[model samples]
Every structure is written in C-alpha cells, then in structure tokens.
Target: MTTQPSPSDPAAVALELERIRRTIEVGFTRTDGALALLVQRHDQTDEALKGHDRRIDDHDARLDTLERGETERQKRDIARLDALERARWPLPSVAALVAVTGLTLSLWQLAAR
Candidate 1:
C-alpha cells in the first residue's frame, strides 16, 4: 500500500528541499571561481617558462662567442711562443763552448804549477 505524507510533514520537506538547493548553488559558485583561478595560474606559468627558455638560449649564444674568442687568443699566444723559442735556439750551444774553453785553460795552468 502507498502511504501519503501528512500535511505537517509537507512544511518540513519543503524546508529541507530549499536548504539542499542553496547548498548546491553555493558549491557550484565556489567550484567555478576555483576553476577560473586555476586557468589564470596556468597561463602565467606558461609565459614565465617561455621567458626562461629564451634567456637560456641567449646565454648559450654568448658562451659560444666567448669560447671562439678564447680559442683564437690561445692560438696567437702559442704562435708567439714558438717564434721566441726559435730565435733563442742557437744561444745554448755557444754558451756551452765558452764554458769548455774556460775549463781547459784553468786545467793547463794548474798542471804547469
């Protein structure tokens, strides 16, 4: 058998229904606001990441330029050193002969004494 609700129960049921409706409305509004904030945050994060990537690319280009300059300078320095060494190559042999002559003269004088 189907039971019909009493008139006194109708008022209580209406009040409960109104409360449920208000709760649902508040929940949907809060969720919508949260979703909007999340979308804004994601857009900002994407822009910041793009900026960081661009800066990194610029830094890499600068580093490559500096390395090329350094390599050129090192090559020039090595060439200059090589030229200096070539210019001085004969001095050591001349100095060695002079030392030997001096030693022979000293030994001859000692033997005569």
Candidate 2:
C-alpha cells in the first residue's frame, strides 16, 4: 500500500514553507506597485488643484477690473445727469418771459393808438 506524506514529514514541511514564501514575496511586490500608483494619482490630483486655483485667481482679478470700470462709468453718467438737471428749466423760462413782455408792450401801444 502507498502511504501519503503527512504534514509532519520534513520534505512536505519544506515544500509548504517554500510555497508560503513565494506567496508572501508576490504579495509584497503587488503592494509596492499599488503604493506607487497611489502616489502618482495623488500627484496628478495636486497639480489639477493648483491649476484650478490659478484660474480662479485670474477670474477674480478680471472681475475686480470690470467692477472698477463699471463704477467709473456710473460716476460719469451721474455727473452728466447733474449737469442736465442744473440746466433743466432756466433757458426756456427766460425765453418765455421775454416773449410775454414783448406781447404786452405791443398790446399797450395798440390800445393807446
């Protein structure tokens, strides 16, 4: 009868030990590769974030310039309106008064004649 090798056999123990060693080595190698991939992805994410920050800063600066320009334009418009307001009624009022005085003088002269 053929006998199967038991776990207590020295040859069987050595073979099992070699298999376990090979499995652990392969696991370590895969773990190193995974860590390298993780580091690379982290670096890529960091670069993208920095790029976004730069774009946001540029947009903010542009917006500030636009706001300043709009404020200046609004101030100019207000000054123009103030000038118009100052002139609104005076010229027409003076012309109307002169016309009425001339008409009154003509009427008085005709009545006297």
> What lDDT does each candidate get?
0.89, 0.92
Q: Model 2, which residues run further than 4 Å from truth? A: 1-4, 70-113
In model 1, residue pairs whose N, Cα or C atoms come closer than 3 Å (at least 3 residues apart or on different chains), thus clashing, are none
TM-score for each predicted model, relative to the true structure: 0.51, 0.58
Decoy 1 TM-score against native: 0.51
Per-residue lDDT of 1-113 in model 2, one digit per residue for the tens? 97677988999889889999999999999999999999999999999999999999999998987777666777888799999998787878899999999999999999999
Q: Candidate 1 at residue 20, lDDT?
A: 100
Q: Model 1 residue 3 lDDT?
A: 65
For candidate 1, write residues 55-95 as lDDT tens digits. 99999998987777666777888799999988876877889
